[model samples]
Target: MSNKIKKKKMKKRWKISALVLVIIAIIGVVGYVGLQNFLKWKAPELSGEPKVGEWYRITPEGTKSANGKDWHSLIKVGKENKVIVYFFGGGLAVDEYTAARPLNDDGGFYADYADVDFGVKFGIASNNKENPFKDWTILAIPYSTGDLHAGSGEYEYTDLNGNKQILYHNGYINYTSFMKEAMKYIPNPDTLLIAGFSAGGFGTSLLADDIITQYFPQVNNVTVAVDSSLLLTDTWHDVAENMWQTPKEISDRLVSDNITLDSLTSLSKKYGNKIKILFGSSLRDEALSTYQSYFRNGILSTTNENGDIYEKDLAKMVADLQENIPNVGIYIWNEIEKNKDGKNLTPHTILPSPNFYGKKYSEDKSIADWIVNAVNGNINSYGLDLLDK
Candidate 1:
């Protein structure tokens, strides 16, 4: 063969190889795009509301006295005609938190609380150890920024990726302003049981009195259960008074704080006999030491110079109520800690995930049984005598 002829053949072979490589690359890109689209299309169906679930989102604007914030609430109505309204705590600035909330829309993280369901069944067992409600309706609200609620000012907005969203500024006020507006939908106050874990629990205590007096005067007739809450004590009661002070008007003398212990005590009084305050505590809770120092001293000292809190002094409160009030049911579960270092170190933080620390209270039947007792009105037997002393 001639030299030129051989060179031509080699060039043709190289060109063919290059063309084949280009074709393979195009096919690979097409397959990757299709796979991503398929996953995106299927993700929504999985995240949609469960068969027995109902979801609601509420935004309460700030009022005149209190600057409002936005918050998300999820109220899951159980099988039995009973309802549990869950208040979730998240975000530093109100707008940024609400903007990334999971209840309204499904992102990478949603329904990460003990209340939500897993594939096989609900992750958290009921007090009865059986799912009581036929259905559950969840309400989510953004309680931090006024933009979400009726409070004054605005909050900075951040994107889904945690990038600086829109910079917004809003006046700071606690969640009472938001709760007051939420009372409009008490959902047949008679059958409602208000409960929250962590920050939601704090909000429950803050709103318990109002819900009792203003919305559910029959709170004595119903159950108010809280899990992993009642830790941080607030200072002011209503936007108006502080029960710890002799004059009640002394709230004005204090600096601006969101919640007060006096408010919780006074709120506890309205439906004294009817309201059932149940606490779920973990002895080794990593945040316990920090919260005890920060919130206990911070708020309790202002009003209760003696320095009292539900965790440390629960026995005394139980006794005092037993001595005076009738039919005041209280249950306390001293949850055993599973991990020493705290597996869910950041569970309580605004960032949500299933990585919880302490022990798993949901699967424990004892915790479920206690809840069932409260539901059936049999909780009066839980060492009422202990509270008496």
Candidate 2:
């Protein structure tokens, strides 16, 4: 073939290939966006009797997320008589500035809505064979209201654009309503595990008492596990009292800046050996450290200094809890991960991570094993050496 003709033919083929690639890219983008939108607006429907081992998304009436979106929870019917009421974490909105901006992701100020699909295949809520709570019925509460699942009042704030906005801050209401619905399905569980991660970890510490006293009064075998929940701020009492408008019982315990520490301490004193308390966290949780930085420096920073600060605070908090509540079980793991900027960051919560089943600090005990043992009244600490490091 002539050289010019050969070149022209090659050019034409290349153009065709480029055109096809462009078309595929467009379709992929459209499909991805369409899927996201569908998931966001999909209405939940659960028909007939609750089936065992199947997850059902339930949207109880009067449940609203921070952004006024419809809130929902996930429940799975299990063959066992044990029940796990788990609260998922997002972030917190402590003030008007934070309330107006709900980032709906990790390290954000808060989440605007619950992710219905979250926890379907993770940790205690998963169907994984290695999961300790695999057969236990689950009531998974997704965080969205930005009040650590403890607020019941509406908060008004001004947006960055200067527009007035109202945040639901209705976490207390949402969980209570969902619990009522959950009781209808799994009414008489012999063993009840109340647990939460990050923001929800704070919730577990704050609300476990109410849950036990109000709902499962007859179940004596109860355990509470809090994962990676920490926020050092002096305004916690004020925020709990005025902004979140938490129950007096919960707010009154906020005599100190660390809500999780305060609540857990009070709970230990009140419940004593009646309820097993397990607390776990990374030595330098990136998410919690960033939040701590925000509270300390008025900016969200994930610096090595901030991480050191978090570690010091965590060590002190652990020591205080141990001194105040002698039997409290502690689990501290330091799993090195990376942040978006490629900086070294310790992972935040383990209960919802896939590693929950296999990750271990002790040679014979995985976090899951430790949790199972604790739930069975064999409370012991794991990963405590990480704190020394």
Candidate 3:
């Protein structure tokens, strides 16, 4: 071969080799991150005790977030024995069974907290013109571990790329540690309302009864209000039960509650009138429709999953649950006022929402009045506030 030809071939060979190396490196990084993206967490067992009538951030001893930092909750002082616990909602970022995420793929958002001055920024925490629980003490728990902030899990799963990873799913761990210490501050609450929206709402359904039971002796009335988080389906429930370690976390000991990770329908049925449970959701909430998609996971093509169908199904689910479960009331809303997207946020999160006060749901009651009923454990007195689709 000629010298010129040989030289040209050698140069081309080196270039091809470099490109191959670059491709390999990119794949290597993706694989490494995929292996690390397991949706799990463990909260350290909290030691010592909570202070009474004092505000402090309770960091669980051994609990670590997906970002590898300790997670904590902020407590604010309020009236003696009357408190409102609101679980802050953020989207769940992890789906173990190869389901595509609607937004970001990282579970790190589960523990993400913005240290805003809740007393001023949050209307629910402060005395607003229409808030009923303005004077009540507030306990805000931020969602950190992606397991709907509901699982107490230590699990392993094989990702889509065939990489095995371990997940902590330590929401139960975080709650147990926080609640145990919370008792010190809330020794005897005459009325306690546990409320949350979105993923936090789902978490409340799983965890609220635990609080009622823990303070059963002293609490005269305990109510739970779950907002825009009616994400229950048989398809994803089986996966969540196994992969998220959900069984024990959902088993409510407060009442003779027959716990099942299968569907909320039966769970609510068995929970008839045990404690007042109130639910609220928008007819066409975009945010929740995406989360609700998680319930069908692999059954429907993730991309083709019908949002309208899911939204109607969700509304129907809430309506049926209310009829089946006594003391279980619901406030269903629609786009009856000036809303941003018209269809989506007709009313996503009610308690923390600016529309929580006015915006009539019925002729005699506003959203604020319905909430008061929820906190007071009133049931079957309100009808659906559905707007035309």
Off by over 4 Å in 2: 1-44, 104-107, 338-342
Clashes of 3: 12
Candidate 3 at residue 20, lDDT? Answer: 19
Q: Total clashing residue pairs per candidate?
A: 60, 0, 12
- Alpha-carbon local distance difference test for all models: 0.35, 0.79, 0.54
| lDDT of candidate 2 over 131-157, digit per residue (tens) | 878899988888888898999999888
Cα error, candidate 3, residue 132 (Å): 1.6
Off by over 4 Å in 1: 1-52, 58-80, 90-129, 134-190, 216-220, 230-264, 295-327, 335-365, 380-389
1-389 per-residue lDDT for model 1 (tens digits): 43234333332111101112222333454585653443232111223333344433333343221122232233333444445544443211122333333222322111212212211122131221334332433333323331212123333344557675432222123244445544554455346565544444455554555455555565345555544433333443322231111123223432334232333344455555456655443322333333343334321011121222333444544454444445544544333333453332111221011112212233343444555567667664342332343
Work out the TM-score per prediction. 0.48, 0.87, 0.69
Which residue pairs come into collision in candidate 2? none
Ten contiguous residues with the weakest lDDT in model 1: 11-20
lDDT of 3: 0.54
> Which has the better TM-score: candidate 1, or candidate 2?
2
Q: TM-score rank, highest first?
A: 2, 3, 1
lDDT of 3 by residue, 1-389 (tens): 43234333332110101111222333454474542341122222334554443445667577654333567766765655588777766655445532212223332223333232232223355455466666677777766566666667766656435776655666667777776766676656678777776666777777765666665446657677777775554334544566566655463221221121222444455555556777777666544454444344322211223456656666567656656675567777665234343332333555555456646765577656776776665564344545224
The prediction achieving the highest TM-score against the true structure is 2
